[model samples]
Target: MVHSDEYKAKRLERKKRFMQQAKKNNVFKARRRNNFSKRPNFHNHQQENQQEQQFQKQDSTALRQRGFFQVLPTDDLPQVPQCSHGPCLLFEKKNGPEVEETFFACAIYRNQAEFCDFKLTFNKETGEIEVKEAVEGEEDAEKKKKKKKIFGYNRIPKALTEMSPTDTVLYCKTCINVFPNKHECVCEPVEREALERPTHLLPPVNEQHGESQFFFSTETLDVITKAVEKSKVDGILCIGAPRIFENIRALHPEKNVFLLDYDKRFAKFFPSKQYAQYSMLVDHFFDKIAEPKLMEFFDKSKSILMITDPPFGVFMEPLLKSIEKMKKRFVSTGKEETLFYSMIVLPIYIRKYVLHGNFWMSDYRVTYEGHKLYQHSEKTIVRLFTDLPVECIDLKNVAGYKFCEVCDRYVTERNVHCDRCQACTSVEQGKWNHCEKCDKCVKPRYVHCAQCARCHLYGRCIQKHDE
Candidate 1:
């Protein structure tokens, strides 16, 4: 037993030695494996390093291309696409040192014996027009001087001035009606009263009242001008003779203009049917205005360029049907007389619910000719007709112009009235130069309107503003 026990102890010691040697070898192999894996020459290690570097570079680039680094409060961001300035904020606000003259021109048909509705709203007892003292801002002081000349007011209207609080008889020109205040009488009733007057008592002729129609700001004018200039059409087809037509006419006088409305009085205003020919026809009615008259006048086949602000509800369907009929006529007549542009300023619901048709997009063509030689010719139209990245239509033929492989396409040049240049619009945005009213940077490349006190760069800048 003693001999056996000694042999077993010797064997056990050998076994322990073997296990220690094995453990040491295993540690050495593990170290070698780790070093080999981390070596830069290996594909896995090099790939991992390259991937990490690429991810880091990508992350840095993403951070660099952000707008408004700090998260603005929810309220600060403009919810609706309007003058970022909140409600009534733009209407009745005092101008600062940076803002120039707020000498805004407002037109009133004096014959209507109605008090100023807006004036009456503030002071319930008095319908008197408030006259405010002019501020000492550089822009305002100059504007105040202009106002004195045009409005004949010694000072700007900041508080009630024209009439006394107790005086109930407001002496407007022709249509006289006693009202608690100007705001008491609705706009429709006031307009009706003015219409009743054979002739307005205060006669402000076209020449004298040139600045009366200057209610549209220079910024609004810029947007309208851009929309008109960018528009690819032979001319504009104005449907309703609503108050908006006056503004449209003032905005785009260069294009061939046609107007159709049920109101004979509105059409009668354009004597000799000169600048804009108005068709006084009333047959079919849908909304408040005539629809068939507009559709019939829309027959000048080369695709009518329509832009109007129609009333909502009833007028929507008739207008859409008229548009659809017009579109069908173009499609069925074996001529692709596509509606070049239909820029309706009214609500989209009125367009869809009332018009009752899909607004299909037609291809637009944009092109440029030699500036000097083709200076007084109709602007070339480039047709973007493809669904891919960039597709457009080429204005190869209109009425009689035939395309020749050798000399390209040529047409007899019309008078200089139709000559147009391809123009682009850029809205302004910058630090320290934001419009106080709109709170947006005015587009660059536009000349600032000293009179209107905003930026404007279009021929239509000097159009009529009188309602």
Candidate 2:
């Protein structure tokens, strides 16, 4: 008898579930077995055998020495057993005549666990041992320069000079540079209430948010101001950072600045007309753009400029999806541009993200006022990724900008000035090839595959081999 299609489908589903469960159980069992194999057994036969041999050797040595030596007795002398191992210099003071008066110790320098070869000199008079690290010579600096040349740009360039302070513009304490004012100094004295406000006004400290809500420095705010003024940005959409929205609004009150955040507390800071709460994690908010409430918040006619500091640990997918939803509402027709500026606040960990043709990185190290979660008194270094080109701003003693030959201007980080191609390309670490056919430089190791009639990644196209 043949089974019905529905019945067979249900049967297949049950079989698939059972197979998955079986596979999971097998993996668990394998892991358990591997863990058990790694554990050291206390009653190991080999260790016990070694101990037995040691005892036997001691007994035989005692027997051989018994007939050759005579025992001596002294009533005043303290009993001391001979050391089985060779005389250890670490305990030498205890064996000497001045044993009662002197102390002895031996420690691995700089907390090194293995192969400690450095000799530490001990002063008997002062009861101290001094250890100094070997000095780095001029050769070390030359080696560093050589390493920098491999990347085609200096990590620390000589061209960046210190800026002089001016009374006309307010200089950031962290960045130590006057705010650039082509028209007028947009910098205003922050109110005492705003400065003294609770840190909770920012995003909450949580794993999902990466606990990374830090206030931008005065200089960084100025940089934002310059970008806004230069691009003639009319509408601002701030995600996750309400403070940034406030700053932009204060600078350009005429511009339409809106704040979109997951937290409801941000609404108190901004007007009812400007602030809208939207959770990125919620599929209804991020995925649904046609919703009346969301549509009302985003206007289609205006050119929107979005600025955000997304959670570093969270994948870019959710953030991108949220941006897509916003763009659907705010993006205008014709030659109007929608600018996106994102901040990735992390230490020197290299993260390779998918970068589109529109994306351009900033060279300036954005200084951030640390929160309770980060608890750093000093401002943190943040990398800004933007679609708009920002004028190169350098922090004192920090190499933040690089000269781009193609753009005829100084571009930001992760951008290379390719001498061979005679253009500035976004190729990371200055790695690229000058494609003769394309008459341009291409990133990511692409080779000319004649059979494919285009350039493909090295060894990727099968048609090239077939040709």
Candidate 3:
């Protein structure tokens, strides 16, 4: 078959365009690779890297001043201060309420409208946060920043500013450049980390992972433990603590200890009876063990304090319950011990469970995910705790799909989908991965000739619940 003249000409033009584009792409890739390879020999690269480190240090210091931390002169940011007990970036408000919300990257304060008892303040004069005057122009300036038309400002959190892409007019310690955005910066994580949080006193957590000193950074761990211990909480309960919790226990053994997890293997490390004393609720982090179910173990009469690394997104349960009990008793009374305490790292599957109500605003140590993957803010923490109730729901709605402990949700022969497959089953499989062949959940090591795009487990990854 012969093609028409117009078709042939058009086809040739298209081919020429494709070749040019491909050639351009290849050239760009080559240049990028060459530049990366020569970076070590480039003295400017080292100098830029050092400058970035200095900028990050400045930004990190600024971060601690959430409501507004003081920016010591470029020459005078004190030696990361003596954070031997708490977080280096953390600071005491010095004058406000005894317990001020903790900000990972910023200082937080409350205006009089939010709290009638006393307005929280940040004193630049005394470095003491006190109840004070409404600074004129400050609110307007901040509102102006908020009102600016920026595509990602709504999605991007204020906490992310210090860590986000380096901005030309704003603080971005990563690239050491005053560039408007981080999109093109070629800064390394090490340089970023250095700028975000000075490590003059302690090395990176990874290098010290196995070593006892690194494993237990006395400064950080002690600060974390003391922060919890000093709190007004009555008895403390810790679950699925990973190895870090052990450090907490070693530091403050007097705090009540309860090890709750599905990991029966750890039970072997402790003698049977001792382990038994520490109640093992035998629930996965993702399981929505009903609040009523938890009630059986809770003594509502006592000032009970609870803690757990709840599956992601479900951290709001305990706070909601505490608010519920608050209607009947004083919040400061510790009446909701069954559902209150410090940090809880939830997994992705169960993260959205907390969005149904005002429970998202419970005041506590920190509602945080480990690894600092995103913006860490004390303002977010405080907002979560102090917000008033607008609506309430039975906590189980957020719990997620349900399946009995002894059900086979995965067994199928004729292209079957199990309706009973509720919670994740791969915990039993010991390995979790996508199966390109089955187009379904399967062991990570599955080998097959054909591949499918869908996951074999929950089918396709369900959209992360709208948080």
Candidate 4:
């Protein structure tokens, strides 16, 4: 008994010494710094105040020198309510040393009224102003008010429904033809050789390897474009959607766009230098194949943007892990202020990995380009989780979601919009669980049972039916 106790004591001592040594290592210190550095900085108040003062001074000087006080003589400036100093301004005036003849532009008149009819031109040599009225046709006015129609399953013409199956092809939400059809759609044929292995390695679809294709609608791409443009993102990393990559490249040709996917076929679409083949299923996938290339891209610039539509079932873990790896590689110590934006499209129910409070959820449902009516009862209520501020997006045009006045963005908890149910379920309860099959949210611990045709609590199904 004495000998056994001594052995155990020695073992414990050795383990303790090993841990002590590990703690002393530089790698361990780096890991600790990475984890704890994300905490809110409480000591920067003085520095922040100085920066704000300097910024205000610079902004006031710039606004004043831009000839904001010089009004066109021919045009009439609309009268508006005046403040104690002058006219009510759209932008707040600085309280520092005031410039001569500088007055604030009327907030309502400058913004609310139509400005397209008036054009202002300056002559450099003569220092003269030219004000011309723009002559626009009724057709031009109609076009300006019309919202660009987004192409989706909902937008398919009713006449297409009457067409014979022989003459029309059934396209999935991703715009892939899974059913029998004779009509030739615009979808490109799958490059069998380009797939790293097969479709089985991709996601939820465990079937035989074939054409596993999905494309983004034009309207969806437009929203993405606006977000990227507003954010001023210079480097983009796209995961699954090739159509997104193509559109992003066209929109911002100067920006560095990299594509990482299991589809080797993307090599043909983009130069070999721009594409990298990666399987998300493999552990440490980014470190093994993506790290070097990512470092090279990230080193070129600090502003990096990532957009991904991860596969169903196991989306959050691998996707978040990949994001952490990217952050570690790109964001070094003292570079926490580096602008990083991520736009993730995943089902609303998967909220386990969302414990980190850095992301904001969009209230709208994402309708994929080729989503078919038979496969999905309604458009899937996928959330657009992002770190960017809500002000970067125009909430009205984004669809199905609204900006919260309190949070300033569509948050995951307490702000969910159900399109099919036509309700905003934002009560005092925790986040709602959306069931795609039922086309609405079910109470916590409850699931939609196909047999009973309604959501029921787990392990308490009263209606006995075959699975």
Candidate 5:
């Protein structure tokens, strides 16, 4: 008994130390930063989430950690079994990031989304691929094939009328699938009776993986919904903001809200007609049928409003190219480029990317649901960048903002219009002080340096900043 007590004490101490180290290394992140972000992330290289460099026949082609789902220019692997993220890559047991059998995986594969089930066993010795038929019950197969169109926010599957009490109504969080009440699962399954509705059982994909999936707060969703409500367009394209898409659909049943997101779990909520698994950065659609639907929407609607909340640090160059491609595709359908405007939600720090695109940042701070930083208070970094007229932003509904006649823009009440600059100039963080030397308004933290002839942090000059 004394030995057992001693072992318990030592184990508890070890656990305490491990938790401290985890906190220090940022093991639990609110938002996953990209490889190029100023923020650094410590990955568990030996654990399940580790991504090792691929040593394959085609050395040039590799899976990008940044989650840019671009189709690689390689022919080493056969394209017969292509997944949503394009051609699958061969993963050998020897060079795998985690302990695994030799297999092929979707290029942008991640456990969080569980977006694709496109794993094929590849024998390194035999140089052959093994295909396994998915053996699902006929009832489950029928339930999957019966894609019910969700007309309203209360997305009750119409086919549920046939569901009996003995049906597989229990949801297993570990497997992210519904199972029979008595069926074996990794953990205790959530009872159907415990939920307010069956749709409530659809677990939120809150984990950070290849792409960050921070949902918008109810307040943020309300603000965006108001904006969509005032729009003249009947078609709403929610590129990455699923919350916004659902809200728009719920409130305005007259209008159609289409969701184009990378999260495959969202498929359970929405029908294929309304939702498409897509990577906006590379402008690739996971489903072949998705394009025609979007094109049809574009052709039918006289005008469409695009509101995107893309992952942070997404390659702006390719994103712009994708937008341009959308416009081109619309034009090719023998229809004039409809009145398509965009409202992109991004960090205020990366305003340089949208500088020349006729995109202007509204004074309204875009808050999020589960994001650690952009939740509330002074740390609100996300803003609604839009191509719509400044007057279109209804700051009157929200607080802390007013319309500036001189600047012809909506700005925070803290922002003082700079007559010399002829612009509001103040960003989302707070008010900015105008520097006569730089002839522009800079952040409150920046100091005008005479030597560098620019506004920057104290003791940090451009010459030595890189060092």
Candidate 6:
């Protein structure tokens, strides 16, 4: 049978594309093989690699024997100043003690990029950190000039919004752009309803650098939204916490709710006026349209609430600093009388360090839907730390918690009021016992060591709780 001219031409076009792709693949394979062949003395290097592995094992063992650590865990760490990027963490040299023992560097230094230029030398004996100048050579300067990869952003056409609710649009995760159809995308594309519940179909948590995202479970989202409703704030600012923003927008579309998150996927899913591509660590906004939109949110609401569950392992200082910068920006928008409030979710164990400057720990434990550790209600270490009035945390609908009339706050049922402290002292696991020598409530496992002049389990870390 003879085909029509249009049908034959379509088949020919498909054949050309297939041939072009196959040719490109073959060229790539040949170049990869050519580069592999250029390696010097491959067989001789295998023997050297084997010896090097053996040496590394022995070296690691020796380092462990001497109590030298590569990374100083969070519990062992002390409160440090914040760099523009989240927090500064301490790292050990893993070398001889005669040399530098420890130093504080940017948390993002190794995890993502070397954008932060802050470094400090720690005096273990004196417990002080001094700024250390970074030495930049010519090679280092050249690397600095080479910027990281940046992708262009494109909005799904507003015309799609005028279509039926079931109408869908195409989005490409690889190109970080949206298109009307796969033929125009030039990248692998997924189709979803642009106006209706597109957030439900967002790509899984970003495994890439510069962000760590774990969304809130449905129950957790309910509790947060309820809290915002009771506050009756004019606006809600969700930093690195998109679920709250989405929930508030869905349930109360009239209320002014905005999201600032590092995940650019949100930029594609939500309208520019409602969401912004934000980085909490560097306090930067990648999208240009976000600045005016943020100011617009500020002006509409005299009272604004900021809810943040930043990336795991972030420090308290930088998080607070970034919020202040945002708060200042909001105040500059001519709403100074509108008090700014925030609820920062963090590990329960770190309450000791973060309970300053109007921040109070709430008994409402926050859990993630798919997180490995924080998914459980009982053992989850995550808790809400808020500057709002402690009396405002109503956990009547939640389980395993009781209200403390004396302190006017909610706490775990395991927490008992300490007559001496005159407050509910229990934080993480069990009821606390007041130590006569320490003159304060301490964990039941704590044993006061007079020589050390502190309450701690000897030969163990004090910061590590029942995990």
What is the C-alpha local distance difference test score of each model?
0.34, 0.47, 0.34, 0.52, 0.66, 0.69
User: In model 3, which regions exceed 4 Å deviation?
Assistant: 1-14, 18-227, 242-245, 263-274, 277-302, 310-339, 348-350, 356-467
TM-score of each: 0.27, 0.42, 0.26, 0.44, 0.63, 0.65
Ranked by lDDT from best down, the candidates are 6, 5, 4, 2, 3, 1
Question: Model 4 clash pairs?
Answer: 172-370, 173-370, 173-371, 175-370
Model 6's lDDT to the true fold? 0.69
Better of 1 and 6 by lDDT: 6
Q: Where in model 2 is the C-alpha error above 4 Å? A: 1-212, 281-297, 331-354, 371-382, 389-405, 412-416, 421-467
Per-model RMSD to reference: 27.4, 30.1, 25.7, 26.2, 13.9, 20.3
Candidate 3 backbone overlaps, count: 29
Best by lDDT: 6
Lowest lDDT 10-mer window, candidate 6? 458-467
Tell how far residue 185 is off in model 3, in angstroms.
Answer: 55
Name the lDDT value of residue 111 in candidate 4.
22
Report the C-alpha lDDT of model 2 over 207-254, residue by residue, as the tens digit: 332333456666676766666666666667777666677777766778
Model 3 scores what on Cα lDDT?
A: 0.34
Could you tell me which 10 consecutive residues in candidate 2 have the lowest summed lDDT?
80-89
| Steric collisions counted per model | 38, 1, 29, 4, 1, 0
The prediction achieving the highest TM-score against the true structure is 6
Worst 10 residues of 1 by lDDT: 81-90
Task: Please write out the lDDT profile of model 5 over residues 1-467, one tens digit for every residue.
Answer: 45788899999999999999876555323123233344433454453243322222323223221222222222354453555465554444432234346666654452223665667776656767786765758457546545453333213243233457666565556544454445576645455444322224455556554466777877787777777777777889888887788777766878866888877766655667788888786577867778998887777766778888877755466566677787676677675664777888988788788867677888788887667888883578788888876667777766777888998766788888888888887774467888888888988999988777788876456333332
Query: Which stretches of model 1 miss by more than 4 angstroms?
Result: 1-221, 241-244, 247-252, 271-301, 328-335, 348-467
Q: After the best TM-score superposition of candidate 6, give how far the Cα of residue 98 lies from its true spot, in angstroms.
A: 8.6
Candidate 6 structure quality by residue, lDDT tens digits, 1-467: 99999999999999999999986764454343344364333357676466546645663324323333345544444677555554556667654434446777665543334455666778777878785555668457646545442322325535355445553445565655555544454554354433334445565564634455678888788888888888888799999887788778778987898888766766655677778877675466665667888898888888999999876667666566678888998888787734899888888767776788888888887898767778888868888988876656778878888888898877889999999889888876588888888889888888888666668854333232211
Candidate structures ordered by TM-score, highest first: 6, 5, 4, 2, 1, 3
| Cα shift from native, residue 110, model 6 (Å) | 3.7
